[model samples]
Target: MSSHQSPFTHPNDSSYGSLQTPDDSEQAVVSEEDQEPGPENADTDSTFGGSLLGCDTDTLASYITDYKYENGRQYHSYRDGEYWGPNDEHANELQDLAHHMYLMTLEGRLHHAPIVNPHNILDVGTGTGIWAIEMADAYPSAYVVGTDLSPTQPLFVPPNCAFEIEDCNMEWTYPKNHFDLIHIRELFGCVVDWDDFFQQAFTHTKPGGYVEILEHAVTPVSDDDTVDANHFFTKWGETVIGLGEKFGKSFTIWEESKARMEQAGFVDVVEKRYKWPMNGWPSPQHRTHGDDGGKSWKRLRELGVWNQLRLYDGVEGFMIRLLTTVGGWSYEAAQLFLAEMRINLKDFNTHAYLGVTVVYGRKPGLSRTASTETSSTETGSTKTDSSGFTVHPMPKSNFPGSYRGMT
Candidate 1:
């Protein structure tokens, strides 16, 4: 296991004091005395209100087409049963919310890979196509392509972005050595053979291009031991893990992705981990106590609320089909289990959090070697290396960009 410290401060820390209930809107508000001096002045109200299940009018104009109905939920018809989650309005809304949570987690950066001015980018399993659209806008010079099993992406996308309905597990039709960066997010339990997945990624990536993956741990844990083995959340996690094993697609792939990428001939593989508090349990006092990726106490509190909401919105979509088909549980039995799990999910006192890991690697070539040699002094400036690969300095903005208003 990686020795990365949990970004959360211990629950027993005196600064945290006691857990408090969030406001009726499910937003956490800290008194001025508890807040750290910072430049962010956005309202503390939850961004989740107003048209909760609504999609952008310009985007997703045809998201309701060609879905298979199951247990009152909608699943993708193409390669149906290949994936466990649903594709209906509720599920799509949850996916968009999850994307917002990821933006908050990453502190506004779309990806952690160091690649710059990528001319060709790909997003694997681009649910709802939110991230791909953002990337297209971020890099107007790059032509972004998003692939998925369903045509759930927006019809009205940027000119530089396009969506393809293709099952990634099958043989890829993309030209070999094509993409500048391949981004894969939250595909846990959707892939049967990760070795083949990375191999395809390696082959399709241009020499010196990068492949980046972002996945969250299915199981929730507590640093202060507040959630024990017998907890309902723990039991739910164990059930999901066992179901994945029976389904022949393990949910624990995030742990082994780095090694798989390296085996696929990718080099300079790097892994970064983060925490998503199950609810608004962490207080403002924790701001000074731990490594929270430099997020403010207010930001962490908001992230906690959003994380909890996304999980609550997604638990049934994540488990229903898997439990009934793979685990052989009756629909009623699965619903009963999910009810218990949801109860634990709403408990702020538990102080549990899910782990998010990002692993990235580069295809080896002279260009990649040249990228390492380039250096930049200006923030957010782009520099071209000897082999024509652009190197961009990471942005340092604390405010979440582009999607902040949508959140």
Candidate 2:
């Protein structure tokens, strides 16, 4: 694919085709005008007219008014309509911290791909565009593009990096086979069609280019019996999985992504799994030789504390409205459930953890032949004996979104 050749043609000179709601359940016209505003389009509702995270007015309004606010947190008001995730200042701050968590999980590396000296990089669903900015700074010569629904990204990004308002579910407009590396993360609920998403990724990837997906199971897991079937955390997971099913998307994407990549014709697919401890009980990194329980215990307690704090607001920011609006729970009921969930998170004895999967695969080269035998591999070792905080391998027979035993 030529860098100069575009993959999609806009329906209108100043706008693309109508913006389909996130779940593809509805449609509305969303202007795709240039980010700059001129006198002719000034004050038009077709474009955003107010300052949003320092984004230009036109960029702010380009999205359909699919926005809603609850409890001081802003949310995407588009279809599948239950994204309780926030796009406010606090959310952005948590995103930055979450980026650090990802780095820590990956052992301080940005990504695990072997690509070298690539010029073009695309980050799909690049919330806050923090990864793009950091990648741009690291790879000075590469032009990085971050695409997302909201314009909450910083205005003073590196010159090599730029942000675009895009829906990953739609036909991408970038040149096919142009990006050296494409990255997507935490898009569990937003994408309705995983197969098409991977197909598009394959099409836009340069021959021999790499695409990586970083996602975690939204459902909580516990190796020990501490997290009972009736526990609030377990119920919360059930509700989230149920909601994903109701909307036709799957929340347990990481569990099925490897097979999806292979099905999409990607080669050399590799998957790595990590554990995200809900509290300090499952973290082996924070332990050391027994002192008087002063420094080590404090550090471990801090880990648990921060995880609790992040989860407290994070779960509310993602579930309160989702449960009330989509799950038919009343506002008061949602609040009560959230309060219980927060308390459960604070209880380190539960030993709950979420599985984080990082998978990367390459587009086959024009001259290379696809091998049918053992085309992919999983590098993550299953640990079931580590202090009862095990990270189980995804079952080979079961995939996400099947809704088995979720109710």
Candidate 3:
């Protein structure tokens, strides 16, 4: 599948989820009926190839297109049976670890240099709004907004925290020459357009304001042991890329963020890559992380995969089995893999040389910056190196991108 824009980017594997029906299972997955295309156009495109039922793109869109805000905080759901969650939103090992990592990013700002007079901040595809809520508490002076499509968020939140139910792939609604910082984490590889997304950020940002993005270098940056050519994660990544191209997204938008930001007239763009060990390994750094970090990594793996696994359930019949059965290994194996992943999360680590790429840029002080006018058509492009892996930019302008690219 070319990384060109389309709507079949991710796969759907729910057919087998129903096939594994136990005689006494309680989660009544309606096997006979196909996915009803939510509240929108459920009546239209009702049939798959006029009769079949697999990988219903329209249906998936309708299912995830709800984001609401109330009080001060935000909320979202992990599609219980589909992908991840029915579990606690906050206070989890993985979320806690994620929070810790986020806090590290905030140290320079939160405790060291207090954010003052900042006009606005954005949390793209804010899942549970946990990060935003925390930031809201930390920076009560700024208006922090989170956007997502699911209304499964909390009705009450921090005084400064607000949520919006806007599809980021569409036209951004914020005024131009606004916003101080835009923080988006974990939306890499799935964002549809890097150019437009960065362009809007540049336009909205107050020239010196920063835009920080934290994303895992999933290609597995390693020192001693590189990611295997045929590892499960690699294969899954390829599958996701193929599916993303089919679904109007590229699903591999991590590599091109810096370039896109530069193109959008951002300056002082800096990239920080870090190795994340799969588990606390033989190295002292790994030892320091210990079980405390390992458990958090394990949960992250489970949630990340589960969150997007259901999208494939619509097309591939055996897909559900592949993910839940064979793909679902014992906890021990996950621990090992996660250990390696964590070690590799950083650059030039003693244990493993793997790391995530943390990139940020300040919007250019262009006096005549272009306005955020959404694109009418979706498009994409990517670059690759010696390895089979490649990177593409996910530009989110005012609109004309996938509303659910990062969902």
Highest TM-score scorer: 1
Q: Quick one: how many clashes does candidate 1 have?
A: 0
CA lDDT scores, all candidates in order: 0.76, 0.68, 0.47
At residue 202, give the lDDT of candidate 2.
94
Better of 1 and 2 by lDDT: 1
Candidate 1 lDDT score relative to the true structure: 0.76
**Models ranked on lDDT:** 1, 2, 3
How large is the C-alpha RMSD of every model relative to the true structure? Answer: 19.6, 14.7, 18.5
Off by over 4 Å in 2: 1-67, 77-83, 283-305, 366-407
Which stretches of candidate 1 lie above 4 Å from their native place?
A: 1-65, 284-296, 368-373, 377-407
Residue-wise lDDT of candidate 2 within 141-212, one digit each (tens)? 889988776667776788888877677887987888888889998898878899999999999988988899
Summarize candidate 3's per-residue lDDT along 1-407 as a digit string, tens digits: 01112222122424321222346556556544665556333323434322223336435544453222222112233231222122233323344345444343332232211122465777776667777776676556777887754543465788777776555666776777677778877664335577888787777777667787776543332344444565444544564455445545444555666787788887778775444443333333332233222334333333233322221221122122223333565545544544443333332233321245567877656322111222222234543323333332322222222311221
* Cα-lDDT of candidate 2: 0.68
TM-score of each: 0.77, 0.71, 0.51
Q: TM-score for candidate 2, please give it.
A: 0.71
**2 or 3, greater by TM-score:** 2
Error of 3 at 183 (Å): 1.1
State the TM-score for model 3: 0.51
